[model samples]
Target: MSFREKMLWVAFIAMIGGFGFYFLTLLTPIGQNASPDYYLGLLFFIIGLTIGSMLVATLILFIRNRSEVTFKEDERDRNIHKAATQIAYYPLLLGVWGSGALFHNGVSTSIMLNILLAVLVGAESIRLGYQIFLYRQA
Candidate 1:
């Protein structure tokens, strides 16, 4: 696979793993009664884990594919990225609007915040997945 493709895979996996764990924990009884400080700490831990993993993965991929690491994107890659981003935007917009609606309906701030985070993660996942698919098809 190309260097960019490998990086995309790494990022996608890291994001899913990190956010999946967070959401799963939130579903537990302990999470429901957790203080704001606990949630803040958990968020920091998750963000750190995700970013650190992605950086490490990128380093490994760079070492393995040093040549490709220096290669710049061409028209096809740019187009694929553009298309994926364009496609992902719809979900993001809808999610934000949905979150607003939830707020309007008197949902808790925590729930709305989590929903926003979920939307961002989901949109990113979709973008990465679409890029991978397009690269493979091409």
Candidate 2:
């Protein structure tokens, strides 16, 4: 697999792991009042997954293709990246606006924050996957 493809795969896996951690933590019973440690642990899990995946991806790329480190993306790759980014941006913007509307309609802050994070992760994953597809097509 190409470096970019490998990076995308790592990112996708990290996102899935992050979501799994989030759901597992959320489903855990904590009686009446939940401790702040649960939330902190969730945040730490996500951060660790993201950083670890990125570090592994970088190491793999450097080890496998160190000579190609200075390579520049070609026109097709650039086009695919741009199109994917554009598609991703629309959902992100819509999500932000929708969150604002929800808040205006009296949604709770915690709900809004969760919605925003979900939207952001979903959009970014879609963009990365779409770009990888385009790269394969080219």
Candidate 3:
């Protein structure tokens, strides 16, 4: 696989892991009544995981294919990305509007935050998968 493809996979995994961790923490027995300190710790944990995962993924890619690290996307990659972005954009827009409506309808801030995060992660995963598909085609 190309370095870019590897990067996308890494990002996809990291994002999924992050989402899982966030939800798990939120669902913990103690997490239900988690203190401010608990939330702060969870926040830091997530940040650490995100940074660490990206670093590890990049390091692996560089070690495996140093030359490919510098490679830029060609026309096909660009076209695929453009198409993926187009596909991802509409739902994202609608999500934002829906979230706003929920807030207007008295939804809790926490719920709204979760909704936004879910939308973002879902859209990104779709885009990444679409990009991978295009890369494979090329």
Best by lDDT: 1
Tens digit per residue, CA lDDT, model 3, 63-106: 99999988788887789899989888888888889889999999
| lDDT (CA) per prediction | 0.92, 0.76, 0.82
Which regions of candidate 2 are displaced past 4 Å?
27-37
Residue range with the least summed lDDT across 10 consecutive positions in model 1: 31-40
Q: All candidates' TM-scores? A: 0.96, 0.82, 0.85
RMSD of each: 0.9, 2.6, 2.0
- Better structure of 1 and 2 per lDDT: 1
Candidate that scores best on TM-score? 1
Q: 1-138, model 1: which lDDT tens digit per residue?
A: 889999989988998899999988988999988987888799999999999999999999989999898899999899999999999999999999999998999998878888999999999999999999998999
State the lDDT at 21 in candidate 1.
Answer: 95
lDDT of 2 by residue, 16-130 (tens): 6776567556556851145556565666777787788778878877798776766688787689889999989999999999889998999866657767877888788879878
